[model samples]
Each structure stands twice: as structure tokens, then as C-alpha cells.
Target: MASNDMIVAIAGGSGFIGAAIARRLAHAGHLVRILTRNPDRVRDRFDFPNVDLFRADVTDPSSLRIPLAGAHAIIDTVQFDGYPVENHRRGLTFERIDFGGTNALLDACDDQRIQRFIYVSGAAADAYSPHPGFRAKGNAERSIRNSGLPFTIFRPSLVYGPGDRVLTMFARILKLSPVFVMPGSGQQKLQPVLVNDLAQCVELALGGRGLNGSFEIGGPDPLTFDALIKLMMEVTKRHRAVVHAPAALMNITGAIAESLPHPIFSRDAATFVLADSLCDNSALLAEFGITLTPASIGLRYLAEGS
Candidate 1:
């Protein structure tokens, strides 16, 4: 598990968080394999030595075998993107991607004898959570924990960086409108973590230090949703009036809009945003020796190409 001998297979490595992890590991001189359904689409995105983009799909257990083979460890960053109902209609949802896919990956890990597993989950993941996605993520976490493999689970809150969907969407909205909609009271807390920092933490875990159990990872400081929006606006050099909407109203609106081809927000995401996404990152800080990156510095990336 030394950095020099690391052959890490990353599921969903074409994604924002997974790609960051791939870059970090590749920079550390590890043989990085990015497993995805469409390898050609993501292959050119990585130019580092010892980096390979291989075709694999998490939901198809058979497709995972070749990519995951001969790897020292595997990192699961796979997540279903669309709304629950929409995704379900397309045969892709948290139940399939998060829960079923995770279980499939775990089975492959066992067959391959890859003991070190790193799962990038969510901060609000809970088995009993009202949000179906969160509950499905919780099911995945349970599978990882119970797999009897040495594992490190990182539940990051609102990860943002350049090209990130959430922050990028916010920047786009700020550019188009004079007024920004604050989903809820704008007082719900969030501890947004920088994508690079989270990647670094995963790299540390890949090196076989503190590679067990779960860790709730977040930024240096927790701020209200409104404060985060203000910081984004300032960094992006945009002036906009922030208006708050009730959580109930926003959820109702999101539910109606969820059937759209691309929804600004889904009912599940809106409901989760109403609650606090804060967590004590003392373990993430001390165990991984990560100096968490603050949003003030990291949100600058969101301004890029904007």
C-alpha cells in the first residue's frame, strides 16, 4: 500500500470528485485506473503518467472485474445524478447505483482480494432519512462497513471546485439574474469542502494510514447557506439580491419540476438542503493531516471561465 506500489482503481473516476482523486493519486506516482462506462469520453481528460482510463460500469458487476483486477485498492465515488423518479425510469437511481453498485464493487473487491476500499459518501447519509437518495447512500455505506474489508468512508458536504455542477450552476444563475433564489431560509448550515482537499484525504487513506471506519469530512468552517452564496457572488464579482423561500414551498416546487429533462433542483435535494450539513472534521484533520481548504479560497475556481 505504499505510494510507490499503489495501483488504485477508481469507480466513477470521470466525475468531479472521482477525477480529482485520480489526479491526486496519479501525481503521487500511483498507477491510476479510472473505471467508467465510456472510457473514450474521459480518457483525454487525464494526461498524467501511469494513468489509465478503462471501461467499466458499477451496476454491471461483470464489467467491473477487468478494471478492478490487480489493483491494490479501490475508491468508490459513483453516484446517481438525476432525480429519483426520473433516474428510476431510466433504470438508474440511488438504489441501483449507490446500493446495488456498491455491493457489486464490494463483491469484486473480495474476489480480487483488494482489501482497502475508500467510499466517498454524503454527510447527510442516513438509513432512516426521509430523502430516498440519502437512505440509499446509507445502505451503500452499510455494505462497505460490513464487507469486512479495511475501508475508509468519507462523507463530504457540498463539495465544490472548478467545473463542479452545483457551484457552476450557481455562477450561471448569478450571471443571468439580478436576484438569486435562496432555496430555504438561507440559514441552514453547510460545511462545503474543496474538491482537491477531499481528494488529498483519499490519497492519504490509499497509503494505508487510518484506513478503517467512517469519517465525516468538511471544510475549516461551517457557514450558513446565505453566507456561502454571498461569498460565491463576491468571488465571482456579481451583485445580486438574495431572497429566501420557505423550505416547504421550495420542496413543492422542486417536486413539480423534477420531471423536467434537467431540473434546477429536485425534491430530494431541496428537502436535504433544509437541514444542516455540518460535521466535526477533527478526525479528517488529525488522521489525514489535512488542512481543510476554506470556501473563500476554493470558490475562486468557480469564477474561472465564468
Candidate 2:
């Protein structure tokens, strides 16, 4: 029930999650402004008639004002490049971008005529947690709650779909290797929601259905990490030996990976991987009326071009 003319601005709209939301809103006839640091580089990606690319970096407070001005709502989906790995030398830590950048956006909203504020927080967000990514998200959530604007925060559990890094990465591994090297015991449960369904949730939140509160969003089925990998194999028709690396070895590998210039997996990333990410979506269903996609059906997308 979103109006066609509402102006919605999305921070990090060039990213995986943000781009999906931008496409969904723009297709619904909303004027979508996509905020990114390098607009020209990503201009070709957004071919929608209603989508406009605005050059803005959440890390730089001064760059945000004009892009966010006069928007009805601002959805923040910004994450530092090489996520879950803190490139501190480049100022790409979770504290600087996720937490600090969100504060900057909130500060910029002072006179921008902004109404609702939506944040795409993670399932592992915890203010009290020692993990940098989790702590940053949890702190950002706190700031959004205290921002005094009617807000909606979504804590999505292991979002997966086309163009996603998580499941797609696993799929690539499954295609290449006879042995799938998994970290830890692979018993941790996950309920991964489809990226499109998450985009629809944002649309519903934009319509003022689920305002002034936080919601945990997830798919209907919760399965163990081992089961998820098996499902991926089933969909792709690639069966492989599942090898679980010991926690100590993973930690050592993560530590070594963190020192690399563009680290893909770190101790923090491993921590995230080993944890359970299940959530009850009754509230999300009640508010957004979303039909959650199961892993069995959604994983079929991996079979394409394989």
C-alpha cells in the first residue's frame, strides 16, 4: 500500500541489499534516490526510470545533506567494503561506517523534512557483544531508536538470493571442489530470508505498517548449516564430501586472513558463521504479509549457468 509518489532515499543503494530495495521501490512508482560514494561507476546498474543516483558517502557527514534533503524516509543499508573484516588502516571498520555513519545520517536529518527512518540491521546485532560487527549494528539500532523519528528496524537473518555473497560463495565452492570445507561443526541453525522478500518488507514498512519498532525477519524453514549445504548440493546437483574444520584451525586461518589487504574471512566472520541465526517471523508476517520462500525452492537459482 505504498503511494506512487513518495520520495524514498536509500543509503548504500549500490550494495547487494540496498540495490534490491531500490529496484523494488522504484518499480512501485516511488521516486528512489540511491546514495553512493561513486555514482558514475554504478549508474549503469540502476536502469529504472524513477531511480536517481546521488553521490554520498555515509562515512563523510558533509556529503549526505543534499542527497537526503526533502526525502519522506531514509533507509540505511550501508556496510563497509570487505564486510565482517575490519580494514582499520583504510577506516573501513564497523565502528566508523556502520555505527558512526548511521549517526551522521541521523544528524543530517535534523532539517531534511525526513519522516520515517528504516535500518537494515543484522540478526547478530548486540550492543553488549564483543564482536565489532555485532556491537556496531546494536549501537546503530540504539541510535535509531533514540533518533525521535518514527522508525522501523529489520534484523534479517542470513539474507540470500541472486547476487548474494554468502550462499553464492558456497555454491561456487560446491561447483569447484569435491570436498566442501565447512568451518566448525556445522550444526548452527540458520533461517535465510529471500532478498526479494526483504525488499518487500521494506516497502511495507515505508507504508507505515510496521513503525516505531524492530522486527526479526527470516524464512519459514530453519535448518542446520550442514543441512543448508546439502540443500545447496541438491539444488545444484553437486554432491561433495562435507569437511568440518576445527574451531582452533578456523580461528588461526581467520587471524591470518584478517592481515591480508582484502580479507574475505576473519575471526569475526567465522564467529558469525558458527552462530545460530534462527528467528520467529510471526511479527514480520503479521505486519508485511510476506510469503516466505523456502531454501529448497530458492536454492534452485544456483542451478542456473552451473
Candidate 3:
């Protein structure tokens, strides 16, 4: 680590968004320690000069010792992936990772005297939201706010990039399916931001621009679900028939699938995609002096990475 550089510990540093932040911060000369249950796996995913991998499972608060040690700030990008919100499987779920894990990290930060905390939440996060995932995110946000720590909570809408699973799923669907299926009239508004742009916002929070409050982050242009699929088709040079159905149909199907050991879609996924994810980034621009990325150009990476 450089003499003047500060050490930043990322709770989920090996994840898609967390890896981007780790790369950006490491390139900027900050020592970034990646805290995850599987440090060996993280090493396989990402490697950089100023980046170090440490074993720390947020669900197991005792494992956070090495990762949080001697850290100046903590960037929490930990979240539960996959469908159906499994609360018991490996003790990983929206409630476990988002709410419980966040509480654990906050307590650890307090113990370590960490100066700053940057949390990456979703655009539709609300404590009272009907969706479990969104509600968990909201609960996490509330915990961070009440922790009495200097913090910045960023709620980004539909973050996408080269290795993003959503876009990759779209590509896979277009390649395999006879017809492209879109839920809820394909009109749900989404302001998809690039993962890099969101990472930059986290970097800004570390630099002290966004502190003590929350900010909404999104792309320059907002697109509907149908338009986003069309754009993906255009990017991948795949021309397929498109079909639309009521969002209720997806929910019903997902509800049935939730009973299975592994489900392709969950009711939570249906509700999450059906909800509007639009956000105004004027505040982000004015406050941080950062320009948002356009969805059209941002989707280009999908083609190259595909």
C-alpha cells in the first residue's frame, strides 16, 4: 500500500458491482481488502496490485475480523442472489444478507472505528414494500442510518455491464427461446445505469462528496422493459419474435416455481421487474460532478463480452 493511500474494505468485493469498485479504488492507489466467505474463489475472479482477498462471511459476524481490521471505510455491496428468497439455504437470503448482515457489519464497523460506510441499495427499496427483497434493502438502509456512522446510501436502478447476469439472461433467452417473453405489457420503466458509473459514485462517497444521506442513481435515459429487450436484441444481432403477457401471469408462474428445489423465476423476481425503477440523477450529477452513462452505449459491452 502507498503511504498516502487509505485502506478501504469492501464487504462483497468479489461481486459484480463490488469487483468494479475494488478495481476502480485499487487503480486509484487505495488498498482494497475483499471480504467474502470464499477468498479463493474471489482470487479466481479478480486480481489486482493493491487488492487483497480475505475470508469474511457477513452472515457469520465472527469471520469479519481480518477484513475489517485497520480499515478506514467500508463499502457494503453484499446481497442475496437467485430467485425465491431462500431464507434458510446456507443461511443466505434477502433477510439474512441484506438486513441481518448489514446490522452485523455496522456493529463491526463501530467496533473497528471505521470512518465511512457506503451502502449500495436498489431504486425501489422501501421498508414497507410488498416485495421481500426490497423490504430487506430498506431495512438495511434504516439500520445504516440509525447506526450513527458517517454514511452514504446509494439506490441505483437496474445496474448493467459486461458480466451482468440480467443482460446475459436476456441474451441466453433470445438465443434459446422461440419467442421473447416480456412481463407486464413490457412497459415497466427502468433507468439502467452502468456498473462502472455506480462504482464511481461509491468512489465519490469515499472521497467525501456524498455523505450522511441517500442519493438516487440511474442512467441518462430511461427505457421500458420492452425497449430494453429490443436494444439487447439489436446489440446481439438477434432477431426473434417478442411476446407480452400480464405481470400477474409471471407472478402466478413464479409462485408455482417457488415450490421447486431450484426455480428459474420467483414471485419476488416478477414483482421486482414489474415495478418501475426510474430515478432522477440530477442530484447525483450536481453533488458529485459525475455524468451518468447512457443505456445504449452501456449495453455495447454485452456484445463484446458475449
Candidate 4:
């Protein structure tokens, strides 16, 4: 318990993004505490000198106040995935973790006298989004805004890194396929933000109080969904059975894929991805003083993990 050093607590810190943020902060000589449901799972991950571990589920506020105690800052990396699966470490619905969890975390932070609160949110979430997933995150951001705490809301475009689900999925497919079947025309644009750069932004967000506002962050460039697949193929040195399935064909394929394991195309995933997911990274560069690595460079980091 180094009281002199800044003590930081992170919610959902064992996952991919959170792990990166925790590791980066820990390496920067910060006393890091990560709140997770399974301490055993993250024990080895956070075995670094400056990092600590706490077993606290976001769905349960009873244990939150204790872990957040004495922390100077809190970084919430919780990404509530709606996919139904056991051993997900969280059993609550997306609404429960996304909205309710923020309130509980904020209350705990306030109780702990936390100096800064940084929330990692997706770009799709906003003041107006018809999608339930986006709406939940929007509500959570609003909750943080109303909590009277110094908060910085980060709306990062599709984050991809070594262990990111997005890039790994494409890499796996590209390794196996000679041709890829993309949704509709595969012309939808997406800005894949690098995880390391995102983690750096989070670190910067914690260092000072100036970045205490909402900002959307993305990569240096936007690429089409099909273009990304080709890049993955190039990196993997594998050619894919490239197919640009028509929307009707994708609909039929999605129906069958949805019923199977690790489908190549899901209607929900396709809808969000095939639609434009763009954002201005200027806020991350100007306000946060962090410029994100390009997608091509970031993909290299991911492909190396394989």
C-alpha cells in the first residue's frame, strides 16, 4: 500500500483492453488495482510489482466500495457483450452491467475520493442510438456525467490489438479461407483504433484533469470491411476465397451461420460493421496529446500475436 503513489482501480480489468490499460499503467509505476470476478484468472496477468487485484463483480455493489477504497483514480474498461454464454464472468444482462454497473462504480469512486474517472466506451454509443447496446452505453455515460465526479468518457472506434476479438476473427478466417464472403458490397468503412494507443490515451486521461469530458477516438484512417480482410490475408500470407455476397445472399448465409459455431457472418455483427463506424481522432491527439497508430500498423501488432 504505497499511499504516496497514485492508487488506481480498474473495473473489468482482466479483459483484453483493461489488461492493456492495467499493464501500461503498472509499468508507468502506478499502484494499480483491478476489480474482477475471478482473481485466479487475472492473478498471473497482474503479477507485476505495482499492480494489485480485487475480486469484485460489477453486478455486485456490496464489494465495490472496499476495492475502490483509497484509490486516486478509476478506469472502467467494462465492455458488456450481449452474447449469451456461460463462464463469461458476468451473468447480468447488458443493461445491468452497462448502466447499473456505472452507477455502482461511480458511487464507489465517490466514496473512495477517487480523483479521476475514465470510462472506455464504444463509438457506436451516443446521445441518440436506436440500438439497445448503444443506448445502454449512452445511459451509462449520462449517469457518469450526472454523478458529479470528474469523468472522461472515451468513445473509441473498433479497437483491435494482439488479443482483440475483431482482428483475431478476421485473421483466423483469412488464415483458412482463400476467398472471403463479405456482407452486402463490403464497402462499409470502419476505423480500427489500436489498443496500445487507446491504453496510452487512458493513461493520459488519468495523469491530468484537463481531459475531463467526452471525446470520440479512432485510427488515422478508415478502411472498408473487405479491404481489411485482404490486409489480414496479406499479413497471414494466405489467399481467401473472396466472395462479395449480395445482401440477400448474406441474409441467407447469416441465418445458417447464426445457428452454427463462430459464424463467418452474423446479421447483427454485419449490420454494425457494414454500416459506417467512423470518428474523429483529433480529440485524442489534441486534448489527450495522443495520436493513434494506423490500422495497418496496428494490425501488424495483432498478427504478431498469432
Each prediction's whole-model lDDT (CA): 0.84, 0.90, 0.84, 0.76
Candidate 3 or 2, higher TM-score: 2
Show the colliding residue pairs in model 1. Answer: none
- State in Å the error of residue 135, model 1: 1.1
RMSD to native for every prediction?
A: 1.8, 1.4, 1.9, 3.4
lDDT by residue for model 3 (1-306), tens: 332287999988888889889998999888889987788866977656998899898888888876898899899998665633553445657888888988999988766777789999888889998788889999999999999999999999988886777878888898888799888898889999999999888887788788797999998898999899999888888878998878779889978877877666777878877889988787888889887878778888767755
Q: Which lDDT tens digits does candidate 2 get at residues 140-240? A: 99999998988999999999888888799899999999999987999999899999989999998888779897899988999899999998998999999
Task: State the lDDT at 232 in candidate 1.
Answer: 87
- Angstrom error of the Cα, residue 116, model 3: value is 0.9
Model 1 C-alpha lDDT per residue in residues 114-144, reported as the tens digit of each score: 7589999999889787677788889889988
Candidate 3 C-alpha error for residue 151, in Å: 0.3
| Total clashing pairs in model 2 | 0
Q: Give candidate 2 misplaced runs (Cα > 4 Å).
A: none
TM-score, model 3 to reference: 0.95
Question: How does candidate 3 score on lDDT?
Answer: 0.84
- Residue-wise lDDT of candidate 4 within 1-306, one digit each (tens)? 342368889898988889999888888888889889889866987667888889997788898988888889888887555332111234444467777788889877755676788898878886477655577788999988888888898888788887677678777767666666676787888888888988887777777734568888888888888788777777767776777768766556656776764444455544555567788877566787766787667777645654
Against the correct fold, how does model 1 do in TM-score? Answer: 0.94
